[model samples]
Target: MSTLEIKDLYASVETKEGRKQILKGANLTVRSGETHAIMGPNGSGKSTLAYTLAGHPKYFVDSGEALLDGEDLLKMTADERAKAGLFLAMQYPVEVPGVSMTNFLRTAKTEIDGKAPAIRTWTKELQDAMTNLRMDKKFASRSVNEGFSGGEKKRAEVLQLELLKPKFAVMDETDSGLDVDALRIVSDGVNRAKENTGLGIMLITHYTRILKYIKPDIVHVFAGGQFVKTGGPELADELEENGYDEYLPEGSKESALA
Candidate 1:
């Protein structure tokens, strides 16, 4: 099985004041077919870790190695990282106003696979995936995520995840803007991808709702830019009731509660 390993990762972001550190020696490993949930309070560096691994330009890795099957992900470009079998489902998926969803998905698939998918087979696959997600046929012709509702945008993200078939996915708050029915649809898509391809997942979120559907094998409490506690699914139940207060420092606990 493939493995994605994050070793002592430290990362930062640029702000008006200056470059501020966000990830201070974070580490985790996700193997194929395993789901790891990263739960944390706001500004605890959860998203920073996600973006850092995805090779987002805004976050810089200070000293660390994000190795995907022994290859250093920190050295690859964002697209390169994707080609290497990593995917990021952003909390806020951006719109591509002029790119048709059909074209974008096929083009990305070609690039990642180093060959074009047969037109007839690809078309059928695309149609089936969208149908499974309960997306309307018109979305295929629409510009990627443009004019779509929040739930639609999230479904579109999952559409890419299913089509692209990445080895590992860092899903950043995928359940954010979804209602119960929409949440189930999106969660089912994630579960399908995992079952079909043995896709590893690093699911980052603040609540336990999605965990009920996605069912993480391990739960990690991220605080102070590093993992402070690790447990099974029961940990999520505990966090849901207690919140991050117990996990935060004496000073940060007050702000987290507020």
Candidate 2:
């Protein structure tokens, strides 16, 4: 089975004040078919871990190792990482004004697969995925995310996840800004991916509402830039009831916000 493993990962970003460390020796492992929920308050470095794994240029990895089925993910460029079966569904998807959704999705699939999908099959697959996400067929002609609503943008993200069929996905607060119906639609798509492909998931979020829709196999409490606790799905219910108060030290609640 495939595995994405992180060991003592420490990363930083350059700001006006110079380099600021975010992830501090965080570690985790996700095997295919497992969903790991990363729950924390704001600024606790959940996004940092996701971006770092996907090889985002903004973050600098000072130390640690991330391996995807025995391959070094840190050594690969962002596109290379995608080719290696890693996917990141960003919280805020960017708008590509000139790129049609159809072209973008096909191009991405072709690049990652090292081959162009047959026109008929690919077209049918694309339409099927969009329909499953409740997206309009006309969206295929529109420029990516341009003039799209928040729910539409997130649905597009899941569409990519479904069509591309990545080995593992890092969903960074994908539930944010989604209405109840949109949330269920997106969560259903995620569940379908996991069931169909045995796709491993690193789901980053703050609330447990999404947990009800997409049950996690494991729950991790992220705080102070690292995972302070790990447990089964019950941990999520506990967090929902108690919040992060018991995990955060006195006067350190701010650290949980990430």
Candidate 3:
């Protein structure tokens, strides 16, 4: 079984004000086929952990380790991390102006697998995955996420997740900007991926609505950079009834970008 292990992680980012720390001693262990929900207030280090794990250059890992299976992930570059079966679904998916989704997905799969997939099989598989996500067939010819709506961009992210079949996925606020229907569709896609591939997921979100659709095996409450509490799905219900207020202090609700 595959496992993603985070150990005493400390990360920081550069700002106009200078360096500011985000993740501090955050640790969690996720094995394949498990869904872990990370819930916290705005300034908690959830997204930072997601980007840090994906080897984003802006987030510097000051100390500690993130391991995939048994390999060190922090030492790998972004592409290297992808090839090692680590995937990140950003809260805001970026637009690739020139590249069509077809070319990009094919190339990515080729790069990760070290060879191109069979054309006939890949084409059918892509069509099926898109259909399952309720995406238009014409989307294949368009540039990746170009001119797409918020929900569309998010569905595109899940489309990649379904096709790429990564060992571990860090989904950062995937529920953001999604409506009720879109949220359910995206959540279903994620659940399907987890069931089909035994993919371990780190679902980061500020609200618990997404949790209703994609039930979490473990719920972690993040505060002041690291997790302050960890529990079962019941924890999410508690947060939903109350709020992050009881868990976080008054001035601790700053934006996570700090």
Q: Model 2 over residues 92-166: C-alpha lDDT tens digits?
A: 999999999999999999999999999999999998898899998999999999999999999999999999999
Q: What are the runs in model 3 whose C-alpha is more than 4 Å off?
A: 253-258
Top candidate (TM-score) = 1
Per-residue lDDT for 241 in model 3? 85
What is the lDDT, from 0 to 100, of the residue 251 in candidate 3? 54
Superpose all Cα atoms of candidate 2 onto the true structure and report the RMSD in Å to 1 decimal: 2.0
C-alpha positional error of residue 198 in candidate 2 after TM-score superposition, expressed in Å: 0.7
User: What digit string (tens of lDDT, one per residue) describes model 3 on residues 71-107?
Assistant: 9998999999999999999999999999999999999
Q: What are the RMSDs of all candidates, in order?
A: 1.0, 2.0, 2.5
What is candidate 1's local distance difference test score? 0.95
Model 3 Cα RMSD, Å?
2.5
- Return the candidate ranking by lDDT, descending: 1, 2, 3
Clashing pairs in 2: 41-257, 41-258, 42-257, 42-258, 43-257, 43-258, 44-258
